[model samples]
Target: MIIGTAGHVDHGKTALVKALTGVDTDRLAEEKRRGITIDLGYAYAGDLGFIDVPGHERFVHTMLAGASGIDTALLVVALPEGIRPQTREHLQILSLLGIEHGVVALTKADLATDRVADVTVQMNELLSATPLAGAPMIPVAAPTGQGIEALRAALLASVPAARGSGGHPRLAVDRAFTLSGAGLIVTGTLVSGRIAVEDRLVLSPSGLELRVRGLHAQNQPADHAVAGQRVALNITGPRLSRDMVTRGDWVLHPAIHAPTDKIDARITLLPDFRLGPDSVRGPDSFRRMAPGAHALRQDAEVHLHLGAAHVMARVSLLDTDRLEPGGDALVRLTLRQRIGALARDRIVLRDTGATRTIGGGMLLDPFPPRRGRRTPPRLAQLAALEAADPIAALTGLLSVPPGWTDAAAFLRARNVGADEQLDFGSFVRAGGLFLLANTFDRVRDSIVAVLGAHHRAAQELPGLQAERLRMALPDRPPVAGFRGILDRLLDQGVIAQDGPWLRLPAHRISLSPQDERIWAAVMPLIAGERFRPPRVRDLAQALKLPEAAMRMTLKRLQRMGKVTEVAPDHFFLRETMAEMAAIAAATADADGLLTAAALRDRLDNGRKVAIQILEFFDRIGVTRRSGDVRRMKPDWPRLFGGGG
Candidate 1:
């Protein structure tokens, strides 16, 4: 398990890590001389390890990059300066990031009296609503080696035994450097995945491919490493250097995973930053940051520092206006800019002015949906993430995008996966094919509904048009998706199709009382003399039907061969098609010859339709040769009449 250190500057964060592991975190010359950590430092202890981050304000951004993947936190407070600015800020960050296991280390206990008990009370109050509420508070003096063993024991106990790390390797590089002999070495806690020697890998954001040259844990070489293990990897590849690889860059399997810039996260603000509307804002905040802003508000604007990139973002809060102390937030951090991120990565946020660490949280989505201040259901959608099970966690995040019909492939494209076992509440039957848990019955119901609508109007009519299907489900998946859904419905005998239309297997059009009115007053005017037929308005008035509804019914009737519509206001019976076909065939050629122009003028059709007809005839050898005034081929009868 990874243990993270947080407190004010010179609070012994480094000393504590070193004392526990006998490894110094002050790798930089400036840090030792300045007597303050300006960069991220690391070390390991028996089984517990840590990331010792800078506590000064300016380096809060650096601290954030180092704050990720820590399962346990050591909130260090110097006894003399108990509960300083960064102290409060770091605790708030830990809370937001969901560091459930932690212990308070009060340094220089000898310098303050037992009255320093007040400090622990203050610290507990700070953690009140956070995951670490009521955790152990230990006072220690590194100089005297006081309470050191107790601190170590607490950490070891806090870190749970490692679970399955047999999947892909996810190495988040918080520290990258070149050893004297080793070309490039990136060090970080192996958060959740594993890696092996000589395994091919890639650095994110740039995706520069490389090979793992070597591996180590706590500065010593290791054959392999697993999740929750603090390990250093010796690597080499093109353009692989400290500059090319910064903190937050992941060393993982090549095609298995990539980074994200826009993400969904759970965040909370620190108690101390004092960020009011007047506070200086960062470039990433879409809107201003006000004072007393304690919660991650829905649609609230903020900045996200992911990996090496910074982005302007909007917040999607879980359920409340404010996250009281330890309360959690289900927020979507929509970035105006792009950054490299992976699912479930942790991040830190700071005030643009003082650059103080305000809060940080774990990213649940690399590309989260944009919900501009929606209803409570949206917030509830995010609240279910705290549960274990990756599949369940993903299913909970399922929501339709604005103007979308379903959400499966969209989720898949973003690398979201569900357990084969979890089911979505909506199904194809409910017009929710994108949901994971939908059953076949739901799919059948959806098909039946569409077919039923068509059958009720006219059993002999074709199903709904493809475009109509698309429009009706403007918010569902896509129409091209219907084929697969229909296939399932057909297999279940829920629906059938005639031509382009759909229907229930046993269903047919059975016109209602309105149909009797239409049939009695119509048909006569349309069965013959289809060309230049009576006006549709006259037909509607004759049938005593509303003009618009009449037109719809007539179109449906005509499609079903109950009536034939020849013009915009005129329709003809299907039976008249034979005579019309003969009229068309007679005009095709004269003296056993045909011309493209003759076909156009005789048919009085547009260029496109005329060309289409002529092309069909030509392809069938109905007109060929004879210097473009085409002679009728032997197949003329077959092409124009028999075959048609």
Candidate 2:
């Protein structure tokens, strides 16, 4: 487990660490001369890794960088000072990051021996509402061996067991440097998954692939490292240098390659934060404004800290126009630069000046929907996401009807199981749209119901057109998703597709006795007038049938491929249209160009009939029309079954 040190400046945090581990964490000359921690420092106690962070207000960003992967916090307080401003601020930060397990060390016990009882009362009041409210407080002094062993024992008992690396490997680099013998080394807590020697890992946001040359767990060389352990890795790859990999960068598995610039989160503003227009007017105005008068209004610019990365972002409130102090709301953070993030990752939000941490929250969706911000459906979805696990949240967002998402987005945002039991292709169909297994089943059932109704209503028709079938469904999937469902159903022999229509596998068009009599009369008339077919009115008059009945009969024939409608009032037999196509192919020149007059002369037809036929050819991609002349398309031979 990684133990992080949190406290104010000159609180004997570094001195207390030396007493327990026998190693000094302040390695910088500036820090030693100044008598304060400057940057992040590390020390080890057996299997426990101590991340000793700076206690100064200015180095809070650096402190946050180290706090991202810590399992427990060692909150240090000076007995003489009791609870300082930095101490309270650090506690709030630890609470924001959700660090629950910790031990509060009351340092300088030797000097404040007579004040110990009073300081303990103050410490309890300070931590009453924080994450470490009930944590044990031990007094220790570095100069003398006072309560040092007790502090150590309290830490060991309070720190939880290390979690196993069950997901993809991700190590956020808090420090990167190069050694003479070791090419490049990156030190950080192994946030998740196991990394072994020679395992290939990619640097996210840069997408550079590198191989692990060596591993060090808790200052000892090891062949493999697991999650929740502070580790150093020697890395090497093409064009790789220590400068390219630095603090705020991530060494992650290749599967997590997508970087997001927007995140949906549930945030709570710190109670002491002011809420009003004066808060955002400027730094001068903010300093002049009353503490409780300022608010974090919508569209306010701020700095977002997640993992080890600090980015500029704008806060867009989802449910409200502004957020009051201590009030919680759903929000969308639009980041200025992309970062590697996932659902449920703890985040801290700081003011634009980066001076103080205003609030923080849990990331609910790393890639949230871009529309319907204030709508009920969108709000409900976001609320559900806040209460769901990573896998459940992913499935819920993907299962929403009628859109495709980036496959990499979903895969990268998932907190677990990229290469485990989840089959991405199974739930997500082609075109990168995610469909849950249950969603696919629901769509399939809807299709079956729509087709069944169509068969009952229009038995004389061959089947419903594919486009019509899609429109008939009450809840339609995305176009590609619908097509994928059709393909699956066809492969399973649950449905049959004929040309451009779909039907049940056993469905076949059959006319009733009355319709069959009407078909017999209509067939003879259409066959005799092959080239110059009668209109609906003329056919109805000749057959002594209603025009509506005649038009319905002609439509069924057209669907059955017995007749073709070339224009609004024109009709032709299938054989006649085929003959005309053959004649056009024979008469056209090398360019496949022909005039309406030439076709009319070839078929002994009027100008009106020739024009209609040419238009029909153009519609089906058989021919291209230029000026008054028509030219067969490049693929006319294949479409018309004619020699080139």
Candidate 3:
């Protein structure tokens, strides 16, 4: 279990830590001069991990960063200083951080006299409304170790048992840097989940995927790390820099968790500041945080502490703009920096103006649904976001791209688990833009709708070519993304094609009225005959129509399935093949030798059309190749109603 220490500067917090671990926590020169814990320091005893934090007012942000991931807190108030400016502020921060399991450490007990009762009473009054209110308050002296053993016992007893859910590893990165001896290293409390050496990882909010090069806990190598334990990690991959990453970053499983920028929270302000302890309002009073406010918005410009990351954000009040002190209200905060914040995570709010403790709230949405500047609906969405099934909630609000999900990363925002829809090898062939299965269905339906409408507009056209319809998609990334999905649809029998042309299998182009007229006249003129049909020029003259109009009619006739071309200038009545069948039957000899000229004699209408039909028959395998002539297949007599 992880525990943190909080108190005023020179309150003997470091001395207490040293007494607890026998290791000096002050690592900075400035801190040694002043003899104060200027930054976060670390130590541990057995399974209980310790985070030593600075109590100086100037180091509150540092304190927050240190205290963020611990399961318990140790509130230290010196016996003589009982409650200084930072003492109350630290208490407020603890309250905002939701540190339910903690002990109140009353240090410098050696200086206490009969006045101890008064100081204790005052401490109790100050802690009344905070998480430490009912905690055991033990007075101890770090120099003489007056109450060290009892303090240790109280710390172990006060903090609850570790979380045993043993799910995936969720590491909130508190410190990350390249180690001189071990390469890349990161440290934080392993909130839940486990990490083994060489396991793959994805750092979230920044979304960098890497592998765990090594692992450690309390400066020693560890085989595997688990939830509720403080851990240090050595990782290697791209984007390994202090600037590339920072505190509050998440060491995600890649299979779980999504990064979000918006969150709806129920903020509560602590009652320790001068902002009228009684007038300290909840998150709902954040809207008045706008610039140039009449009353300085202490809760206005909030330091939103979600997970292990602390970000600045503007708060929108849920109840009222200016809230009464100690009042509670749910509010929405928009962050200025991105981090690994998810729905339902606890968030501590720090008042930027006074740099004091405000309160903590639960994240309603990992990525909140933005609805203009209105606060009510966003609050409602946050409520949904905090539901038991947060992933389902995300799906309800997700606007995913269409097609088979190619990579699992794209569907993270929808909370699609690897075990859910996509696993090892289910190819999502949305062209190259594969998305999740459901996303692909959405794309296919939308494409079909648009294409079907286009089909109806020009019955003479097969369908909107795939290339053409792809242009209509929103933003139109590329057709490659849609390819995998199209193939799936084709296999499902939802779509069909004729050679290179795609169309609904049940669809056949129909002729327009004037085109139908042209078709009827041309049908008989060509009849059981095959030859290059007249040029559009001669045909228009024969039909007394414009050449362009006649040309359009011929194209329309082609779409209507009434004609086919055997040569560049050729056209054939759909019935021409039948006449070729009859002629080939009469002219064939016993040896299957039949002259092209003999077949031409039977049609008599023309040699060109007859030979064309025979050649068409040969191309289709209805007539077999025999020397220079063509012969009907043996089954021709019964199949085509003719005898040899």
Q: Report each candidate's C-alpha RMSD, comma-separated, in the order given.
A: 11.4, 8.6, 14.4
* lDDT, residue 464, candidate 3: 53
Which stretches of candidate 3 lie above 4 Å from their native place? 113-116, 164-170, 176-180, 202-210, 238-250, 253-266, 269-300, 307-311, 316-334, 352-354, 369-379, 388-644
Off by more than 4 A, model 2: 275-292, 388-411, 418-441, 452-472, 510-644
lDDT by residue (1-644, candidate 3, tens digit) is 78899888888888898898887888889888977887788987877788999888878888888887888888888887678988877777777767888887888888885556877799889878776777887888898988899999998888686665344567888877786777878899887667889898888877787889888865678888877778899887776665667877889787665666666666655443223232344455444344322233423566677666777777767656655456666676777766776445677766655355656667654554465434544444444445545344444333332212223333443344444533434333444443444565566777777767777887767665456667875535355565445556667888775432456667777666777778888776665235345655766788898877876777666555456565443665544545556667777888777777777676674677667767777765468876777767764432222322
Query: Sorted on lDDT, highest at the top, how do the candidates line up?
Result: 2, 3, 1
- Decoy 3 TM-score against native: 0.64
lDDT of 3: 0.67
Tell me the lDDT of model 2 at 135.
92
Q: TM-score for each prediction?
A: 0.66, 0.75, 0.64
Candidate 1 lDDT, 1-644, residue by residue in tens: 77889988988888888778888888899987998999887777655667889999777777766776677889898888878878877776676666788888888887785746798888788778778898888888887788899988877778755645644576767777788977788887676556788888887767888888789865567778887777788888877767798766777766545455456667656544345454434454345546666544445555466543455566655456555544556666666645566555566766535355556677655555455434665555545444345556545544322212234423332333332333444433223344443433444455567557757765566556444654554243445455456555556676665433455667656566877667766777654434334567877887777899878878767665455444455555544443434444566555766666766676565545455545544554455655666555553332212321
Q: How close is candidate 2 to the true structure, as a TM-score?
A: 0.75
Worst 10 residues of 3 by lDDT: 397-406
Which wins on TM-score, candidate 1 or candidate 2? 2
Quote the lDDT for 339 in model 2: 89
Model 2 over residues 501-605: C-alpha lDDT tens digits?
Answer: 578888888676887888788877877867777899999999888898888877777876557789975678767777788788787877778888888888877
User: What TM-score, to 2 decimals, does candidate 1 have?
Assistant: 0.66
Model 2 poorest ten-residue lDDT run: 283-292
